[model samples]
Target: MEKLYDHLITHPLIYVARDAERALGFDLPVRGYYIITSGTSAHRKLAKQFPKNIFTVEAERNLDTHELLRHPQTKKYISDLKGAGIMVFKNTAMIEKTAKENHWKLLNPPARLVNRVEEKLEQVKWLREYADYLPPHEIAPLRNIMYEKKPFILQFNHAHSGQGTMLIKDRDTLDKLASAFPDREVRKTDYIAGPVFTSNNVILGEQALMGNLSYQITGLPPFTDLPFATIGNDFSLPHRLLTSTQLSQYKKMVTNIGHKLAGYGWKGLFGLDIAVSETTGRVHLIEINARQPASAIFESKLERDNKKRNVTGITCFEAHVAALMGIYIPNASLTPLSDGAQIVQRITKKRSAVADKVTEELGKLGLNIVTYENNAHNSELLRIQSKKYLMDDHEVLNNLGEKIKNLLD
Candidate 1:
């Protein structure tokens, strides 16, 4: 295959991320390019497969990209590649400083802008024009919270994968939280029970290109115990859940939000979390992820697989790099592509490992597996991907999901 990113070959390239497997989309065939990730089972596997291209950090536990960049081994690796161009899964002051010190070009939006826009409270104002789509909400400290013996959603200033989000079901739960964070301000909104959806979008100058919309599987048992922890995404299943009108509304919301981010001088990829009310069928904005999303990796690979059979589409990963490189792509080619689904098995009390026999059995079923080593509860332990849908229309796991769950169990 010819070089996927010919232009990027001009400069040394490095992708710094928490999990190396997530950066598979950026594994272009170019010299002087490297992928830096924490040493997990997946990263070790990738390093063995792409010895010269993959670099793993030495750490006792799983760490995010920012921490990995600051590791002694990571610093030594960067020191050897002085002027390389770098891309990070998320932006942070530590990452920017390391890049600047080494004279490497940073290919992401400003950390301050990214951080400011991701705040749950700030999202209310940023998405003000579409206030009708927002859930009935109020901003207040824990001391002033009034759940009224009902379920509600409370979000803190920052968190990832739903850690900073809470689903308060009763007065007792609210009281406990209030006692724990009596002074912290939070965005309290009426609980809208519903199915969640997420989409990845790219911003280039004044234009924003939307990517695929997928059914966000969260809080599923056997995979995660945390009520809001993300499990995976099902691309093919969402069409069964959303009507054409609802899909159009989703696209419009994403495009407008992307434009708003661009107005802040932000560029490249950003993701949006959305919820559709089960009672009223209303769609609401959940939150904004101001950096590369977890879905981008498999979604981009899906597009690549589709292209092999004559399908014409551009992946968010490709567009992200181009946008950061100042390349302009016509809007027609940026349409979202739907082709596959991916599920994650997070480390939890009930499940910890997939037996070797089970792994062999799963491979025979055509499920691609990527394993990770982490002892922290809810850290990703395994990832399963497929070109087929892993869910049924009823929001339950289909044959594939059940098979994987059963095997793991």
Candidate 2:
């Protein structure tokens, strides 16, 4: 923690997120880490572990966090934000564009390096040099890719919380997707069949600290548009989550990716996508998220667990800020608890009803619900905060989906 401040003489970190707790945990003497978030649910509760840390920008349940910060109403915080030591964003092209437009002092990787990663083609191309761990993937025109003999998955390079992802089972969907979205530069690859996991990593220059691995809950409806949309992540159930060989292999892979990222000059949090094929018993590097992943909401919950047990747990975001500041915080990941744990789910529902009413209704049933007007979807995002591992249990998912869908009725 001391090392973080050592790098910057007077550069206070300005953390922007959807909730305050996501940005908390820098051991500041006087609220040095300012949290600029848009909203928190009743269940998406936030507690400032640090003393007197001021939470930001009066969150509206249905508003986007960054957009809220950029809104004319939030112009007051813009001045102080411009003066910060560094601006830490959640790693979207939108945020990068925001920084460029506002000319904020964002001390992450270059925007070009960061934006290139948002696309599947660029990520594959970057990691292609290190082909030992990466899955079999090819970058080319989708039209040419279709002529290959084997069944493959066509990707649009960039995706939003799994929106642009497709299983690509047949030609009909492939043609449909291409016709529907003709502009996206596509890549093709043989689908690696396995449970996909995200290893939250902190890359500090030439070094990459591999964080905890969490199984991604992908493609369940009501929570996502397609079956492939990542709705939640389960960090626990760690009993043999990966094989002995895989555990070591992927650690080395992340380290390799880290050293490679150093070449591009990125010292920040990233999610390394890995797929451990059940049939072949082999692990393969799938993709890379060059930003603070959506799975980071889990860290806020870990902070909650630490409070209950009276322990200090270092959150990835906290450590991420530290890493970017040239400090390596040991144990960036925390094991909170096991056995049917709370799976923090990020769900989106179309805006068909009053969002406040939906929140009120869900809250009445003791569901920690927060609704957001997603700029990507132009819909109300109903993030059911840690009710239970909805994906872990199909019954819960079914019941929850029916309940929310009933709201439309």
Largest lDDT belongs to which candidate? 1
Q: Could you tell me every candidate's TM-score relative to the true structure?
A: 0.92, 0.75
Residue range 1-409, candidate 2, lDDT tens digits = 4555554446666666554434544434444555556644422344344323444455455445557557654455657555674455555557667767776766666667876765677776666677657667666665455644456666776776666666677777677766766665687667777787776777754557676776676665444455666666655533336767877887888888888887778887888887777789788877788877755655545545654677645556556777676665654454343322222234345433345676677666555554543444523355555534333332234455446546533
The worst-scoring run of ten residues by lDDT in candidate 1 lies at 1-10
Residue 110's lDDT in candidate 2: 68
Cα distance off (Å), candidate 2, residue 215:
1.1
Query: What would the C-alpha RMSD of candidate 1 be, to one decimal place?
Result: 2.4
Whole-model lDDT, model 1 = 0.80
Reference-based lDDT, residue 353, model 1: 71
- lDDT of each model, Cα atoms only? 0.80, 0.60
Clash number by candidate, in order = 0, 6
